[model samples]
Target: MKRFALFALFVLVAAVLTSCGLYNSKMASDPADVETVAVVEDAATEQAEETAEPVVAATEEVVEEAKPAEPQIFEPGSFESPDRCKNCHRDIYNDWKESMHAHAWTEKWYQQDFMMAHHETDGATDLLCGACHAPIAARTGQLPPADGSMFDETAKRGISCDFCHTVTGLDQMYNMGHVSEPGNEKKGPRGDGRSLYHGVKFNENHTKADFCGSCHMVIHPANGTHIIDTWQDWKTNWYGEQNITCQDCHMTPTPGVQETPGRAALLGKWRDNMPYHGFVGASSYVQDAMGNKKQAEMAREYLKSAAEMKLAETVAGDGNLALTVEVHNVGAGHKIPTGTTYIRIMWLEVIVTDATGKVVYSSGLVDEKNHVDPDAVFFRVQFRDADGNLTGKSWRAQGIGYDRRIPAKGMDSETYQIALPAKGEYQVSTRLMYRSFTQATLDEAAERTGEEYPPVESVEMAAAQTRVVF
Candidate 1:
């Protein structure tokens, strides 16, 4: 019985191995026949599958490309109407409306000068005074017509809020070469902001000297002659070295330097300090026009701080007095009376008084005809015509024959030597005077406009007094 059981188990194991394919070689003794059966099965399956399959084709995926960024376009309008800003920012708008920026376009003097330049140049206002007086109008293709009717109420206001806020980038330093990227991006001194309007705000660049340089430095487009390079002058001087921005000095109530704390907008967060928009400098004319006494005082203070005068003398045994007067450009970034160099006048006036208060000698004294003494040492720039003739007309100037421009933080000295009869106690005084225009030019301008031009008043930039008892 045990032998029979063992045999049965062995048989069961052999059957299981055959079914699992382990005993295929032993089961298929006729290999050729087995191969024929496999081939027939594969062929029958292929035919069955081919008959049941559909005739659809496989396709490739299609990717969509992204679109490019669009260029920004500015909306055409006037920001001159301070009433619009008053609706939102009442306090700031009130301050601005009372400031000189508001009257920049409508001022009587500016209108007269602009109209004269326009009338004489035959619609050439776009290249001349419009660069400063009506910057927005010129940029928006509204200028070349000084009549103001060509532009709307806002544009006629000159450098308005929308115009300044819309400035996207600067092409060069000065002379209205700024590029306008008009959009929702309101570039300012603060870069960090969240506004509904699609725009960016940066505080650093806007508060720097470069912002003021856009219009302060004027260069002739045709000749490449530097008409005004105030920005460059400041950059090359101590102001740049000290990291002093134009806004640091001009926009502060203290005149020189101070922190201005305020909010940029009503809904904006409060900043410890923000750049003010007063933009006060040495422009008494505009201050008077706007009836702003505080602004005029600020202008006077700026002029007063612009230079320093010193008198040094070397006496000889033969009663010859050699007086050296040094004038230092201390405050202004550009040449002492920078804009419209032809019209700007800067000169040194020396008065020697005896012990009795009688004037012994006087230089740079204006006569009844409003002519400066020819012998005076004048600190001014002279432009030359094509023929090398000195001409007061800046438009006709092709080259600069004499450029005694007072450099930024630079000192210029003039020596006057004269023989005195008998000097007891002499008081020598030196003064640096600045005027808007020459008498001849003002006379011509008055005659052309048939309006009595305002008298040119000289502001004492700096003065020095010394006592010499020999």
Candidate 2:
């Protein structure tokens, strides 16, 4: 009986292997010999069935070939409006309504810059800039009329709830490569929650830095110059090495890492930390200009926490004072003034005052016309055009010409030599100031659009004061 069982098991194994095409794969290649092989296989099967009496029959399961994934197709206006999401996510909607993402497409400053690029490049930059600023419109093919005349009302909302939650995948790391899957199924960090209106599926990408990096990193398609490098800057920094993501900092209301306990939706399960939708950064100027006072205050808090300044001064017998100001990137996970460094400006302001309350020396002070001193020590970036001249216009960039930013946990120092007229307990005050844009940029925007913008004010990021006696 044991020998019979062994023989039956061997026959079953051979029959299974043959049925899987393992034995016939090589023989089937020759069409002329196919008939002979089929006849021999049929005779062998009949013989096996006749001899192996107790063997059970089986059939092979056919495997289908894998095809490439296609892009998610949706009709225009398929993405739901932010107002619809407001019903279940009131607090989040309120925060997002005034956030930069909400105004990304409608913001005047961005529009000014985008239209200028469009005119200069003859609409080459239209798709590039629109992909991030107006993603719904870009994906739905409503973007060619760059003025947004053809855009639906939902597309005008700009990076709203459905747009982000429906992101299925990404095509690349830069230039807004986010893939959209607009439907009833929503993807986010947590998928277990039950919703009456839609299906919630967990997406690991929603929690990773790459989700934000897709839009944050911008590379010029024409010359491959890195226009915005906030994503790469953080990826290579110490925070990134430790796996701290942008969502950890920017998604919170404050500067550093802190948890806010709440439910993501009004009817959803409780979460240890629900992401703050304000998305505040160094945008106090834009926030205040747009009348988002609360968001502007939050942005100022971010600037205040980003860095700290220390002053060191030496008084020479000849009345020559050498004051050194060191700015430390203590709070920000990436470089100070990380995104759009070309348009934004960070600089050192030194003011030496006499005991009599006289303003003896001042650098980096805004003039009557609201322009920062051109010769001030500025921490920013400038791109080099084809002619090698420095330009702030990102669309014209061929390469980086100048870059001086305080890296995460790094320090930058600048020394000022001032000859004291009569030094006696002179107070030296140093401040690290930041501005969203220069007065010159606003002036240019006003010139091109005939619309006046408010004066750009500098936010004091960090400050230090020291007294020197001679």
User: Which candidate comes out best when scored by TM-score?
Assistant: 2
| Location of the lowest summed lDDT over 10 successive residues in candidate 2 | 58-67
User: Ten consecutive residues with minimal summed lDDT in candidate 1?
Assistant: 58-67
TM-score of each: 0.76, 0.84
Per lDDT, the best of the predicted structures is 2
Candidate 1 accuracy as lDDT: 0.60
Q: How many clashes does each candidate structure show, in the order listed?
A: 9, 0
How does residue 41 of candidate 2 score in lDDT?
A: 11
Instruction: Please give me the total number of clashing residue pairs in predicted model 1.
Output: 9
What's the distance in Å from true for residue 156, model 1?
A: 0.9
On residues 186-259, what C-alpha lDDT tens digit does candidate 2 reach at each position?
99988899998999999999989999998897765444466787887788889989989989999999879889
Cα error of candidate 2 at position 197, Å: 1.2
Estimate candidate 2's RMSD in Å.
23.0
